[model samples]
Target: MFQASKVAIVGLAFGAFLAPAFAAPAQEAVDRTFERIAAGVSRAGLEPVVDIDHARLAAEAGVEMPPSRVQLFSDAAVNSALLAQDLSTGLDLPFRALTYAGADAVQVSYTSADFLKRRYGLDDTEALAAFDAALAPALDGLDGVEPVPVPTEGLADGYGILTLQSAHDVPETVARLRAIVNAQSDTVWFGEVDFTAEAAALGVDLPPAVLLLFGGPAPGGVAMAKFPSIGVDAFCQKLFVHAAPEGGSVVLFNSIVALAELHYGTSAPPHAMLDERLTATFAKALE
Candidate 1:
């Protein structure tokens, strides 16, 4: 099993620091590299779930930000194994890679394997290995370069996931959530994923589950400006609604407090109000 080095863990405790660079013109490199990654995911037999254009989102919301994009792809086997261990793991499912223009070179970032294990208590080595291997193709020819480290500690159990009981079944709950989100002003509805359907495609059985993604770039941009890599935190907020074995639907999302601690190394990171705004939007949707 892979363990997070002491250095990596400590880096998360402190603030951001320099990491090895991927030399290229910032804007062009980010878009081109992300495109290559998206193509690689398709070539690897994974379903390309969604490609989020963060820079464009920021621009539309009247917030200036550098070029940034994220590609979310699905690996059925890996998804099944991880979610089997903990349904909340769905929050990070359909694995994503974020590429953004940084100070000197374009930087690529993703959820850390070690952080995933700790946050969800994941121990499926086979699945974890498979997940790690999927990103290898994107690293070709980038010798001695490392992705930006984004290790975070959640404020509570299950990464401080906020769960709500839904009065309806999976489909209805999803529809209601969608309607609520669409009603919000300045919020961009990114996309949604039917995990149950995706797993079924691979001949696996799972209870009804769906993930809804959306963002309010005006607030999201402010949060990201303070902590660039925090986009994974909630800029593209993930709302996971899954059927509970006990017979009702449940909705899940990360708490801003937990994400703040995770990404900014503090529960009270700068621009917290923006995080609050983003969280409230989801809270209203789930309600």
Candidate 2:
């Protein structure tokens, strides 16, 4: 096992983003380390959903970046509990771990449970504990890697998330969003997750929720080209459609502007045109 004793849990005065990193063996490459982590997740009995190669995606757009990949795994039981507590958590669902080549060593990172609780206002302490405990084995035997803190510089405080009220119900809202994405020449359809059905398969009841995963590779490559770390979490765009208590559905997604600031520490992230396109797309979906 790696140096577990060196692992430190620290916080900041502002809303701290809990990103814990683990270092690979000295001789291990990023891809090898990635495989190791994936094998560990399987050993822990978690289902591997998808593995995104951000570096390759950037190369497809004629941009060069370090070897970086983000693999998403699923523990239906834990995810069901989180969604049962708050459907909004679906925005960050199906747990993701980022494996990237750092300046000196290869590292694997993921958003910590503490950050999830603060981000979604989750009050279920037991659920949060269960989440941490479940993923612990996948990260075992790796030494801790910490990031240098940077100032937010008065960026938007909304955590890069945008929520809109949809005039249609959940399924229709998803359909509309899907239509809009399909119509856009620049965007590509990735996949979709029906959270309600997923939970039902596990015999856990959850509210109506569906997560849409899609992205415009051109824009994504542009962002990753400039800020390689964005590939860690923001490569694939997500639109979460869930039933709203007030009748219509609610659509939620991440804004690249906010993501650039929060994740990459870009003081003046260049995301105007991309944000405009996204705004118009979602506006049409909601309408």
Candidate 3:
């Protein structure tokens, strides 16, 4: 398990913008996404890392930058060593924006187990199991959302997950997450979900949102200083069950690099936007 974690980190760099593919999102749309993601994050209660230049954030979101501002963006991208230092300190996942390119809205993420536990004081593994207890009622309130079979794949370190997504409101999904997270206040607010082009392209028009769901349940209470390869069951609980607004089915993989490559063709893990990690090329897929 530990060795697997090592391998994931070892291949950190991905080649720069190989495809020049595009997803054009309006600036207002990008702002709304930032607000939604930030609010969801705030509710989760994880501490923020240092802020990068918001202006650069705008640039990543596809804004035109002045010549002076170009340096700002480049400097922000290159000077992202703070996060690498954080990761080296044993923090498994960091919650923050990676790059908010127009239609290509992306952020740094972790499993529900790690992200939620660290945000709130819910560290005990039982805290995760508590969601199972809450699932029945919370899900009942979810209109248009349907539950389907969960897919499980046997992996050396953890089991892979497959499940049909529910069609639910973005805020409602956040509410459901709050029910599971259980650390949120009585009233919680989520930002407007910005749907990704990929989700839309698939006929799944889920609200654009980031839900760091557990495929199953996390082991709980492990120190961030230790990079423990989460067990198979643990990974299952961390699997994201993204509810497509209409018919969009988004599969949340354990590795974001896979999602980035699969969804946007970016060879590098979105983490590259966070630090000086090595960039990786896509492994050729064989049918």
Q: Highest lDDT, which number?
A: 2
**Higher-scoring candidate on lDDT, 1 or 2:** 2
Candidate 1 global TM-score: 0.81
Clashes of each: 0, 0, 26
lDDT of candidate model 2 versus the reference: 0.68
TM-score of each: 0.81, 0.81, 0.25
Instruction: State the lDDT of candidate 1 residue by residue for 1-287, as single tens digits.
Output: 01112221121222222122323255557767776776777667777666666655665566756666776777777787777777778888867778777776777778755666777777877777777786556444433335764565443347767777876788888888888877888676777877777778778788888888776667666666555666655677788899977776888876666666676576545455754665576566656
Give the per-residue lDDT digits (tens) of candidate 2, residues 5-103. 110111011111111232333223666777777887988998776666655554454555566667677788888899998888888887777777776
lDDT of 3 by residue, 20-100 (tens): 232323333333444454444344433332222222222333432210000000111111221122211112222223222
Report each candidate's C-alpha RMSD, comma-separated, in the order given. 8.9, 9.8, 21.5
The reply for model 1, stretches above 4 Å from the true place, is 1-25, 142-145, 152-157, 267-271, 278-287
lDDT by candidate, in order shown: 0.67, 0.68, 0.26
Candidate 1 local lDDT, residue 14 = 20
Lowest lDDT 10-residue stretch of candidate 1: 1-10
